[model samples]
Target: MPVTWRDLLDIFLVALLLYTLYRLMVGTRALNLVRGVLVYLLVWFIASLLGLSTLSWLLGNAATLGAFALIVVFQPELRAFLERLGRGQRFSSGPLALEELLLGLSRLSEKRRGALIALERRTPLGEYAVSGEILDARLSARLLETLFYPGTPLHDGGAILRGERLFAAGCVFPISESQIGLGTRHRAALGLSEVSDALVIVVSEETGAIRVAEGGRLSPPLSLEALRERLKGVARA
Candidate 1:
């Protein structure tokens, strides 16, 4: 059989669509579901090709049932994907002024000054913000350090940053229910990440270690350089 231009075009379109879907699933629990679906599909194809009639029949019927099951299972991911498509822009796009933020975090870590900072993405944190004093100041390292300084009025709670502005400070965030023996700052960061598509940075008051929380997972203690790279990656994404 000879290949034609139409065949090439059809293949290209399918590849593009798959790529888009993969991007949508990245950094999400839906990615694991996608992997399971692919494995099932491969098994079904092999059973059909090998003339395993019974196995093929079962797999075919399962696929038909799985379509509805998948819709119910992936409802949240589907909604998020559709929302992203409707937005036509990256959810976390914002001012890339990370130099100051990173500098302040590094200083806080060196001083063993505990700090929790959450960067708002597609999901709004207004409810969390209202729990404490609202600063609404420009994002700056000096201001950040001052806010989190020990014995300061706003030093006990988390800070919320939206775009290039500091939206609030001393905000009480939800505590994570994870079994891990994390401090208050880390627990709060993890909790926020679990519910929203926000990136959280935490500095330990006792250990002077830095950690990042995203998508309900926390990275190990990171160096200043590693933290900078991670923040940049989040910004680019």
Candidate 2:
């Protein structure tokens, strides 16, 4: 077949789709699902090439049905992607609120009050919110401190922040069952990072140490100055 403009466009579109799928699978449980899909595709191709019509037809139908199954099974991932796509305008409207969040972290560090703040980015934390109290309050350092303060009922779980709103407090996040030896808090932070792009900050209740989690990796203890710089790096990117 001669190379044509339409062929080039098809190549470009396939490249884009693969790139998106790669990103969607990264650090997510969906990676396993993707592997299963790939294996099924391979089996289907072999069956067709070997003149096994019945097996090929069955596999082909399974592939189609598997796609719909994936959509329902990975509803959270799809919802997060769509939610991020829809928030392009909303982010531009609240640059100041983000600035405030940055400042609030600074204030909390100065006070040495232990806090774990998760700044939701492209990922939806709605699933985790189910484990805690729903607040829907505005995001502020004072409110953050109050929730994490000692003797408070909702002081143990995470505070889930959405945009500039503190949508929920004391929400239980998933803890990794893997033998990474991470403490409960770190495991919870890692669980969220593994599934989403949301940046997680953990302030040690014992030592007030600050750590940031993203891309399934955890940074070493960071100072207020370093934390601000790391956050700025993400915001700019």
Candidate 3:
């Protein structure tokens, strides 16, 4: 039995769909269910190929029941997935967000306040955000400065930006062991950029310098205008 083009097309479509599902489910507990589903699918295919009519019929019926069970058991995850799918399209961060960010960073640098901010892009940073306080507050220069002020509760931890909002504050990020002779804040920024597509900003308390980390590399100290251009480039990318 030679494989036909229809068979090839069928395999390609199924593989593509499974891959998409896996991407969405990654880093979630629901990932285990995805693996189970793959195994079930493989077993069903085998049963059907071997002419096991009774087994195939049982599996086919089981799938219907399993669908309902899955919806009930994974309701929260399913809802989240659907919401993410709905928001799959992204508009630019826009000039307003950029203006707020620049003002925030400029103020923080001028005050020599230590701050770590991760600007999220393609990768989901929910796990990291969970380690901190959820803000979901409007992004503003004064708010950013206030959050990182000395002795504040939100100070001394990373902040996360999701689109135009300061999604979380006091977030903890992984420290990069690879970056030597750097302070904890810079290392953490590097660590996060290495793992995700986020653009991380760091403010130096010692020298009031502003820098950014992306793709695991830290940039030279940037002036406010340069920072604006850098952000614009990232937005365009």
Candidate 4:
């Protein structure tokens, strides 16, 4: 049979759909579920091909049930994906503003002041705002420094940045369950990164070192210049 332009279009559409699904599944627990589904599908295909009707039937029914189970288990990821899809623009920091933030972090690191700052990206972190004192003030380097200064009321907890605004302070973040032997601030940063696509910055009070947490992983201690470059990348994203 000769393939027409319409057939090419159909194939392209299917390939695009599969690629989208793969991209969505990456770096998520759903990826594991997808692998399991693929394995099941391969097994089912082999059973049917070898004339094992009973095995094929059982696998087919299990696959059908598993689809619903996945929906329930991955509800959060699904919701987040839909939310991102509906958003008008991808949230990112401006280069100049990010530089200012890095400047603030540099001073904090120099002073050996501990800090945890989570920059909200696609995920709405309003739920966490209620747990802290909501400032809703414009973001500035001085304000960031003051927020983390020693002997201050809000110095102990994390700060949440929504866009160019400092949305909340004294915000309590979840502690990471990972076996990474880190301080409270680092653990909190990791925890926030694990749950949302937020960029978390942590300053070590003891070592005056800076760390970045993203995608449930923590970066090694970063220098001021390295931190600025990292923030620039986030802003561009």
> TM-scores, in order shown?
0.64, 0.71, 0.63, 0.78
Q: Could you tell which candidate, 1 or 2, scores higher by TM-score? A: 2
Q: What's the candidate order when arranged by decreasing TM-score?
A: 4, 2, 1, 3
* Clash-forming residue pairs, model 3: none
Clashing pairs in 2: none
Across 170-200, the per-residue lDDT of candidate 3 in tens digits comes to 9998777667899999999987766565789
Model 4 ranges off by over 4 Å? 43-73, 88-92, 150-153, 174-180
List ranges where model 3 is wrong by over 4 Å. Answer: 1-91
**Candidate lDDT values, in order:** 0.82, 0.73, 0.84, 0.82
Q: What value of lDDT does candidate 1 attain over all alpha carbons?
A: 0.82
- What is the total number of backbone clashes in candidate 1? 0
- Per-residue CA lDDT of candidate 1, range 49-114, in tens? 999999999999989999999999667556656655553322242444577888889889889999
Work out how many backbone clashes candidate 4 has: 0
lDDT of 4 at 197: 73
Let me know the TM-score candidate 2 reaches against the reference structure: 0.71
The reply for model 1, stretches above 4 Å from the true place, is: 1-96
User: Best candidate per lDDT, number?
Assistant: 3
lDDT of 2 by residue, 82-188 (tens): 66555431212156656666666666656666666676776667778888888988776677778877778887788877766888889887665542787778888
Model 4 agreement with the true structure over 56-159: per-residue lDDT tens digits: 99988988898899899767666656654555233467766677788899888898989999988877777677899999887788999999988899999999
Instruction: Assess the local accuracy of residue 222 in candidate 3 as a C-alpha lDDT between 0 and 100.
Output: 95
Q: Counting only residues 3 or more apart in sequence or on different chains, how many pairs clash (N, Cα, C under 3 Å) in candidate 2?
A: 0
